[model samples]
Target: MTTTTETATHPLEILFQLQDLLLIARKKSEQKDRIPEHLQHVDAAFREISARRAERQERLKAAEARKKALEGEIADVAEKTKKYQGQLPSVKTNREYGALLNEIDGVKREVRAREDEILALEEQIATLKAEQAEVDATFPEEEARFEEQMAGWREEQAILAVDAERAAKRAAELRAGVDKKMLANFDRIAKARGGIAVVKVMMMASHTAACAGCNLRLRPQLLSDVRLSKEMVHCEGCRRILYWDHRADL
Candidate 1:
């Protein structure tokens, strides 16, 4: 069996709870908003690292191809030198022998040139391989770290979502218990006052009173109504709902 005093107190309690819920919701929504930006930065970091790794891999491939081609050229030059050397013993005349000898010298020069080209290519391959190895080794660790951080953030978001859901449910239950007219008034004032629909009056020196929401003087009648705490009251200056602060009396 609820009395008028108890029923009237319900509205204030519900309004307070509603304000709490809204505050918590606002904080959770802000955290949710930050998550997308954080995720974007993480994705960008991964993309940049992946691009660098791909570029390194392409360079390594090119270097390896050059090395293979140089190896083939060296092999071809070696074969030609072998063929020229085998012909040197079969030469029957000095002119033929001299011609063969000159041919051998030309083949040797070609081999030497091929060997130099192969050495340069090998050096390039070594540098490229080193760079590729470094990227490959470092990238996995970086990616793992980023993934771990993202997982933690996701977990936090999940927990916050659960908390927000519970808060929303409690707000809804409390709202249903409140009177329709009072709830509507609260909503209107909250909308007009940027979510500050309710405020407690603060007593001042010299028998004066001020609206806690806007720090404006209240009319004598307004003060009386707030003291009664029977119905909802509003501040004329800020239009915020007002209640008596019993703690101020002590």
Candidate 2:
């Protein structure tokens, strides 16, 4: 990238300004889960109990559905057995009677198996329901224990949401003002460098310049080029865009 006329802002400087807004917005979101130290364990316990109850309820629903299906299967098997037994009076020879008896026995075995499964599913459903009831009875007291602290956490979360929203709006405006090529470069580098693409050259007491991103000493000619700010200069060590520090200490 080339330097602009004296009045125009350097592309890298614009990127630096854009970086500040983006970082602020990201930091605000990162703080969304902040909680009081005293209540952290209580909060975790409450969530754990709630999740346990939810799991129990889900399992109870599945068990009940299985029990209903097993009951229907038992009904179908019983009907088949009754139909086979009704054919016994029509047997004409010993061979015919034996075949009818075998059919009846097979269907009776199926009915017994379905009945056993239904019993097991009913037991599971009852256990899950009991567990759900226990949680329902105890959860309110736990919620009351941390009610005030949780309210404060909620309020702070709301405020953070507002701050993050404002930062997002401003960042969007800044990005819109930036050249697309510069914005793309900034995004690509920031993604590679943990959300920071531009950094000040670290001026040392020993009169050496270092790459702020990497802390590696800049080569003599590279340091000279960074000082001039005539064009975009990437640090040799870190490859992040380098700019002179404009703060008072520098």
Candidate 3:
């Protein structure tokens, strides 16, 4: 009778090798998470400045419209004053001439008020233009800074890409050496638990154990199987595959 010898490799050794690859992959993912955070302030500032520029543009248009209206009112007042002066000579009585002169005075006052309004509108328009100029000068500098930051992010991403490729290749080699079902289960658990599927549990004593991932106490039976390395053992608390490191217990 012919019999085959079963493989004697320990599951913990396989997981230890897998953890090294996972740490590299996790580092790349975490570095990617920081890219957007670094640019958040610049992005928010751009949006706020853009809104201020739009509001100023609208105010400028309103000021120009007010100036034009004031000019039209002044012109109308001038025509009315001219007509009142022509009527002055035609007045028949002293009272009539006095009333005509008072009317002309009122028209002159109206003309002055309109001209003052036009001057105020012109000042407002100038201030708005200056603010717009300031924004225009400042926005480009921020834009250039944003571009520089983006370039730095791209450089880091390029480096991460190479590291990720190496990690993935190592992970593949490790996966092939592990039991197919264990790998599948590990992959599933990692997907559900954010890239952490296997964990080392410290046996506090022969009967007491603590899961490293969740810090939950491990059941005696579960700890025993993990120590024996006889079969796969999963933590009841975190549901992560558990392995005991003898050095940690020592």
1-250 per-residue lDDT for model 3 (tens digits): 3353645556766876787798787788677656568677876777787788889999999999888888888888889999999998899999999999999999999988888888888888999999899988887887787678678777887888788778878988888888888888988888888778888887677678898889999777777788876677888888988877654443
Sort the predicted structures by lDDT, highest score first. 2, 3, 1
* Candidate 1 structure quality by residue, lDDT tens digits, 169-235: 8888888888899889988888887777888788886567899889999988889888876777889
What's the true lDDT of residue 245 in model 1? 57
Question: Model 2 off-target regions past 4 Å?
Answer: 1-8, 34-37, 144-147, 202-209, 216-224, 227-230, 245-250
Q: Between candidates 1 and 2, which one is better according to lDDT?
A: 2
Give the TM-score of each candidate: 0.53, 0.81, 0.51
What lDDT score belongs to each candidate, Candidate 1 first?
Answer: 0.80, 0.82, 0.81
As a whole number from 0 to 100, the lDDT of residue 92 in candidate 3 is: 100
- Candidate 2: tens digits of C-alpha lDDT, residues 1-250: 4553456666677788888878888888778766668768878877887788788888888889888888888888888988988899989999999998999989888888988888888888788888788888977887787676588788888898888888888889878888887778889999999999999888785568888889988887888788775777889878898987544232
Per-candidate clashes come to 0, 0, 0
